[model samples]
Target: MAKKMLRSVLFACLGNICWSLIAEAAFRKLVTDQNVSDNWRIDSAATSTYDRGNPPDFRGQSCMKRHGTPMSHVAWWVTEEDFTTSDYILCMDESNLRDLKRKSNQVKNCKAKTELLGNYDPQKQLAIEDPYYGNDSDFEVVYQQCARCCRAFLEKAH
Candidate 1:
């Protein structure tokens, strides 16, 4: 049998405590559900240092649990190696895209293709908004969006 290709994806947002963490969880769940966890690596990171080492926002945690995609993740800032190592550096919004693009300029062998995670949304939503300043309702929206986009992303990756 031919060896399967292993792919790594790093989901990113301004603070790894919100949308990025949701994306990571959603993607992880999808891959697991598809029984392809061994073929892919999934993680999340931040574009800024504000929430480094912090766990996912409580609201997001509750939202994920409500949707059956419960997750826990510690925040970490994106590094040059993340850019050079990941096959896809999927992000939440324009600010994340801009920040990642700027950071990639500082790295010599950035192999990751940085793009909006929303680009994979079957519903055509353009951005996954940050829910830190909002309520549980906002976090619910983030979960909905991530679920849709992550499903599509995994389908394409397969």
Candidate 2:
């Protein structure tokens, strides 16, 4: 039998420990609930090296647990291969969007359409703020935003 094409998506942020991690987890759950997990590849990465090799923030973990969304991820920076591979490089905030676009241009065969994840938000929120400096409530807000955006994104994917 012929293999199905896998659509690659890379979620990115200044630090992979917060917003991006939430996005990756939310999208993963959305696809799993839809039973289309096998049709897509989802990953999260940072635009900066500051949080590279670290795990998702504790607040984010707590938020996920509160939402019953299972998520485990180690932070890493976006690479040239990621630029050339992902169909969509979705990011939180203008900083991440600018960083990814700048990095994408450095790669000759960049294929990913880098854009703000909030672009998919049904509520018209234009940016998903980094909750690293905030408390658990901030993380919860991030989770809610990610869930909304991810759901909209999946719907549009179909």
Candidate 3:
């Protein structure tokens, strides 16, 4: 029998990745603001499922709940083994980059780049700065930066 194919993909964040909340919000915005379908969606590790279905509210529970955390939206706290196996990985900081690099060395197929998506300065490979420790202004900058990169990714994919 043919194996099942994953429709959506996972998003990687930096240490512990509380930022997935931000990434998921951005994902929702990307779909709604960009008019994309929910069929190809992104969710948090707190809400994904391999069986495929509607998203649930695991707000108060750990990702290891009975429903099982879906790989499509793995949190940054996920193990390196899990992160390396993802179809596409997005990191939020230099530390995330280092971990991914280490894992990538071990797993040759892990081609995730620190650059948000595949688009960048081409020869430069710029990484969007982490805004996890700044004021509203910094968050705005990070949001704008993420929006730009995400739009590029969505445009090419859609």
Candidate 4:
């Protein structure tokens, strides 16, 4: 029997406090539920230095709790190594996608395929809006979107 190759994905957003963190937890849940958690590396990062070293937003945490999804991550800015080490770098929206693409260009031999996470949304919702300034209801919307996109992406990946 051959060993399975490890795949990796890094989720990104401006602050890494809301959208990306939600997506990371959602994707992690999907992979764990599918019994393939051992074959993948999952993480989330910020496109900028904003909120670096901080835990996810309180509302995002509450949202995940409500959905029964577990999340443990600190905000960190995306690095050049991420471009080379990850299989895919999925971001929340167009601005994030553009930031990731531009950063990838600066890294020599960047191998990650960066794109908007919403591209995998079955409902054709192409952007995961930032919910930092919104209330719990907004965070709920982010969770729903992440759940949908993560499930779709995991299905296509495996």
lDDT tens digits, residue span 37-139, model 1: 9999889999999999898888888888887887888899999999898999999999999999999999998999999999999999989888989999998
lDDT of 3 by residue, 27-105 (tens): 5566666556454545443212232332322331232122232213324243445444555556555555566566667
TM-score-superior candidate, 3 or 4: 4
TM-score, each model?
Answer: 0.96, 0.96, 0.56, 0.97
CA-lDDT, candidates in order: 0.91, 0.91, 0.46, 0.92
- As for TM-score, the candidate ahead, 1 or 3, is 1
Backbone clashes, candidate 2: 0
After superposition on all CA atoms, what RMSD does each candidate show versus the true structure? 0.9, 1.2, 9.4, 0.8
> Where does candidate 3 have its weakest 10-residue lDDT segment?
60-69
User: lDDT tens string, model 4, 40-108?
Assistant: 999999999979999888888888988899788889999999999999999999999888888898999
Cα deviation of 123, candidate 2, in Å: 0.9
Candidate 3 global lDDT: 0.46
| Top-TM-score structure, candidate number | 4
